[model samples]
Target: MDGALEKSISFILFIIIGIILKKKISSGDETNGLKSLILTLALPATIFIALLKVKVDGNLVLYPILALGFNVILFAFTPFLIKFIGIDENSAKDRSARLLIPSLAPGLSCFPFILEFLGDDALAKTAMADLGNKFFVLFLLYLVALKWHYKNADFEANSLKSKLKSLFKTLIYEPVNMFIIVALILVSFGITIDKLPNFLSITLNRLSFIMTPLVLIFIGLAVKIKKQQFYQIFSLLILRASFTLFLIVGIILFVDITIKKDILIMIAFTLSSASFWPFAHISAVHFKEKRENTKEKTFDPNFALSILALSLPISVLLILGILTAGNTFTEINSILFLGTLLFLIGIIFPIINKIKKFLSKTTKEIKPITKKKKIQLIADK
Candidate 1:
């Protein structure tokens, strides 16, 4: 099989396996815990190891800065876009989720592709850049977005501080961060493993292989939709896609960024759509909202999942389209094209609802209101 075809097939197989597991499995604390383990531990270690092995150059600074700038721009514009799209004022959590989703590309999915297509050094640089993007989205963007939504509430400050603290603790105490720091130190000191001990290296590689599948499975497991929430979800999706396209095109025009084939691959990865983090944030916000006796609104999980799923296939095709579209589609064109596809997919929630049903069998259970639910809810107060 051809290389691209092979990768595509692998991705499809991964998704299929995920769907099967998700159908048979329940989203209980155990599954959630496993997801956390993969995100906070296995994924980060793989990234750090990959980065540590690669050679760095000036692009190291450039890529991360670009990633951060891209995220900042998205966050700034998402609110206005949300307003223009006419999502209810009470749907701040959903709005934030919408904004944050585009900011979070599937980092794990793109990493291996980066390593393969861009070589070790570019992968290292992209890894650092990705770390910056992750930090900005997870810490800065999320906190501020949450604050904006919860602004009028009496306990907002305390709630914000507590959430920040939790984020901080998670960042600091996570094994991945520690490993990354250690790896960086070793690299800075010009220490090379030359050959990593076979057992250690093998273990790391095994864990790394599991990371992508685990993430995709978690996403598959999280897929959900509601007939009632389709319009709101559709509106938010459109806004996100538009903003993402604007950023991608604007960056290409203003910046002297070269469009290396590797960058093309990275753009494909970055442009593929949002990830599960936004859904997690939505859940957090909903938990807070419930505490304030706000109207109970169900979050459309399929909104983000659909956006992500459609993004992958569409982006791959878009990249191919741009590459083949004569000389007119420059690197900038590729970015804009991919960004626009994401935007379009973002708006098509009805399509997503249809896709979601085909992908997963276990619908999310809407639980009755309880003290636990109240403590966890965070929407319209």
Candidate 2:
């Protein structure tokens, strides 16, 4: 068996263990601690070390540009797409879609697979691409959430300014952002991981190694689906998956694939799970609204939770299919077909309902005429 596949299996088993542990133990605040560890310590260490270790190339520059470009295009269309799909503006579902659609979680979903399957080169490219995604999630999406959050309610100008300032401070002071800055400074000076002090290198390496298992376990613990939300959440996920698949196909058809590694890196990046940043933003919104006693709520914590829970498995499955199928059009074509079908279904759902109602009315009208004819026949006899 392939080493990558073996590692994938092992990672999944650890996730299963996490899920089982969640069942037996009262998670309470421990889940938050795990998430903090992954986000503030583990993931940053991993990304910092990876960036320093990888030899910088021209492709590195192109990768981030492509990643940022993809995000911008998707974000530009998201509001229109949400409106077209009948999601109300400034609503919970709308807010959730806005957050989930543009952001990508390459660190949690794509990085592991890229490292194991495509080797360090591909992983490096993905890490760079994630820089763009990280920016969108941390900065752009926060602004978006804040913008829509204030749309349905009123706030003082001073209050808004204060909130924005606090958000900026939070972003700048974040551990991840700090590490990114450090990595950039090192890159500017042409310093590589090899030149790092041995003690510091070892510490970062040890911290980085915990990232995957901790994140996977966090995902397991976070998974939850209420019976009522199943259909609604599933429909949203299908819509998201369909659109993402469409984007991937567009890239394949138009983008030059001169370098196979670049294409694979692109595919891995594209298939990444939804970022957890959305959940954080939504929870913040909820907390703020509650404190302000706002009756009109635009953010839905449940929707954010559902997306976070389900996106990983969906992303993993898609990435696995791509890797296993040797990145052929056959699997991609299959995804396109499913995506197209889902799109059509979403478009025509109301029409289907109207037609069903019309047919039921016609059947009911015909049944009355048949009864009247039978009565007339009996009277004539």
Best by lDDT: 2
TM-score of each: 0.65, 0.75
lDDT score, residue 188, model 2? 84
lDDT of each: 0.58, 0.73
| Candidate 1 lDDT trough over 10 residues, lowest sum | 361-370
Q: Best TM-score goes to which candidate?
A: 2
The regions of model 1 sitting more than 4 angstroms off are 90-92, 95-99, 106-131, 138-171, 175-198, 227-242, 255-270, 276-311, 324-328, 331-381
Question: How many residue pairs clash per model?
Answer: 15, 0
The TM-score of predicted model 2 comes to: 0.75
Candidate 1 lDDT over 177-269, as tens digits, reads 567677778788876445567787777778877876776666666555455544654556555645655655565666655656544544544
What is the lDDT, from 0 to 100, of the residue 375 in candidate 2?
100
Q: Write the per-residue lDDT of candidate 2 for residues 1-381, one digit (tens) a residue.
A: 766566657766777877888876566678867777776798789778866875646757777778888888878877776665556786777888788877898766777778876788677778777777777886678777877776666666447777678667756776776887899799889998889999999999999898778866776776576764555455555566667668877776786445656666776687677887666666666767888798878787656766666777767776776776665633556657856976765556434445877999999999999999999999999
